[model samples]
Target: MSTDCTTSSASTLTRRSLVLGIPLVAAACVSPGGGPAGPWRAMSYAEMYGPVVEGQYRIPAIDTTTINPAFLRSEVSWTGPEAAGTIVVDPKARYAYLVQPGGKALRYGVGVGREGFAWNGNARVGAKREWPKWFPPKEMIEREPRLEPYREGMDPGIQNPLGARALYLYEGQKDTLYRLHGTNEPKSIGTAASSGCIRLFNQDIIDLYARVEMNAPVVVRA
Candidate 1:
């Protein structure tokens, strides 16, 4: 899918103002005599991926042992023009970021569309759903006959591909039929293995669902 400050009290305050941009811009905002601001504190993998009862379902905990530590959720310095609250997906890098103020972002590892199934450009979060129904596209059903059964739709559950949450992407009035959703397959994070949508860890999606608002802009890089 798609998707500053100065110095002095007046000048100093401006200097310390958090600006979102490439590393160079962020570097210039360094505090006077102070190094970079204190590092962002993120939750431990255990807590971040722990099993929790969400709604009517109990989401299972992720086994971080098999996942790369780098792919885990953390605060990162972002170098992009998107404003705060935007969702940016880097398919090649297998990462999805929620842009934060002050040249920083909340980064999460993601599984993107595989090969030819990948898509790019901009879209907006048109709708949000929890434990959403899964309706396999006709094309997908043709590719995997087994999915034909879901052509009508699949009820929400732990085994559902949409996992704990889904954010439907749209282009103005048109539905892109692409989503930023959760998956039970933690191992898929950081890989190009989806049909076209972006997938995150179940827990991560739950967290993202809560933070994102309606009509949030999304950018999926080529």
Candidate 2:
């Protein structure tokens, strides 16, 4: 069965409420040209985060200027224990890695859960959904009754907390009640802000969703 993390759909809860501290520069050594200074195609920031249209929703182009340049997607060296095709999330570093074959990984900036809400462990991608609906967890509804109205489920839209795609997490046969989903909040990237789920930008999530298959290994680190 599908479960919910701590995120809510209440409009009253502004971005300011979600952010706790200044933006963390996890990729301090990354170059200013939109990604790590390496042998890349030299794609401009505009092309990487341009607007996209899926089904009927038109995802707005991200304003790269406003966000930390290091948070943008890039291919970087990988020395983790996991093999290729594994998904590894470093919540403390606000980054997610999709391990590739050549001792490299495609890294994306992420927004993670706040202090007490963060969780980490081994899990797998149990399922994938495009334009997925969102169901507020019981606890979140209790904290903000406004979300109760969406108890049934929130429709898929650009503003939906789940954004364009969602990868449901599971451990063996049990749902972990966590996800690696997309968010419309570009500013949330590189910050500890979400309730429990790992969030990527819409463009990044769409890219990740297409590459990740069902049952892909996932390791979320504390």
Candidate 3:
């Protein structure tokens, strides 16, 4: 597999940005008084109609950066214990945990299934790609032939399905037929719905995608 961002195989994708030890840097571009310009209004109608995640996520923007902490779940914490493993996704709490030694975990607030359709159990991130070319599985093409054209590939840009990054999931060295990836849907950041893949704000995934390895174990919980 290529460590570089380019798609090695024809089946995968290449990220537009080469992630090479990039540090998270933020300057106080906003004037000191105006109550920080963040958590803007939801863009899509579905998300606007639906409930908001409050401070969990924010609408995507170029200049604005939405880097919220994971421990801000507030009243959404679960009764059950947190999973102990390499990775964990507490969908109910809308947080994903990357377990590490010394009892610390790298946690990130995530957008889960809308109406109880989230994926669970153990899986591995077999491959990682940037701006992945979305080849809708055969089942989708069968139902909607219009998508057949995408079987080839799509380049990186605003319209790309995989957004800024993608982390491919596999179950025991096999493709799980699912992906934990990013989406351009800014409104869908907090709530899940009719979207096909698990969507995250592009910046969030760019952070998450760089943290995990190619074969890291993932455990999604209810």
Candidate 4:
């Protein structure tokens, strides 16, 4: 039940299309010190998809070949201000980094908000959920009346826009109305197509969801 961006209306760009349309740069292509480039070549489908569980909802395997190698998950050197375990999102670079202890980070490609939809600031992972239900915001519904049917909420499943996991961001006591979540569209990994939320591949989100803890610091840079 995954929604296809192709079928979306041209007059009103859906959030899904926004998240998928941003161009991914090859900033990390050379790798540090001219080392072996493109870590994705060394990764296998099994490693990218992991094992399946019976009865549990599972994300469909993505054809890694269809994705840009730059968007593939890999460890990269991070010299940012965030501390270990912090999630730093560089919307301009279309990359998200989970800072590690040794000047390194688990880097994953992300789809961020478009020009006007984008925001920069600090927030905390106030909540996390797996296969979370989706409640289209009033603004989204107004732009795309077709989503009116889902005003109540869409149930958790593979077809759901939230994909396999969602990490809610909060600024102190108030919800930022933003999220770091999985997308059904893997091709969106290196784009600026989302309305405002940050999106990751489903497999990447699962990996991120496991390492991120409640109240983890998240810094989104414009």
lDDT of 1 by residue, 109-166 (tens): 8988887788898999999998888888777776678776777887888788888789
Which wins on TM-score, candidate 1 or candidate 3? 1
TM per prediction: 0.81, 0.82, 0.60, 0.79
lDDT tens digits by residue: candidate 4, 36-101: 111222334334543323145755667777878888777788788788879999999999988877
| Winner by TM-score | 2
Which residue pairs collide, candidate 3?
Answer: none
TM-score of 4: 0.79
Per lDDT, the best of the predicted structures is 2
Clash counts for the predictions, in order: 16, 0, 0, 7
What's the residue-level lDDT of 14 in candidate 4? 28
**Cα lDDT of model 2 overall?**
0.75
For model 3, give the 10-residue run with minimal summed lDDT. Answer: 29-38
The alpha-carbon deviation from the true structure for residue 33 of candidate 3, after best TM-score superposition, in angstroms, is 28
Q: Could you give me the TM-score of model 1 versus the true structure?
A: 0.81
Clashes of 1: 16
* Model 4 local distance difference test score: 0.71
Best-to-worst TM-score order: 2, 1, 4, 3
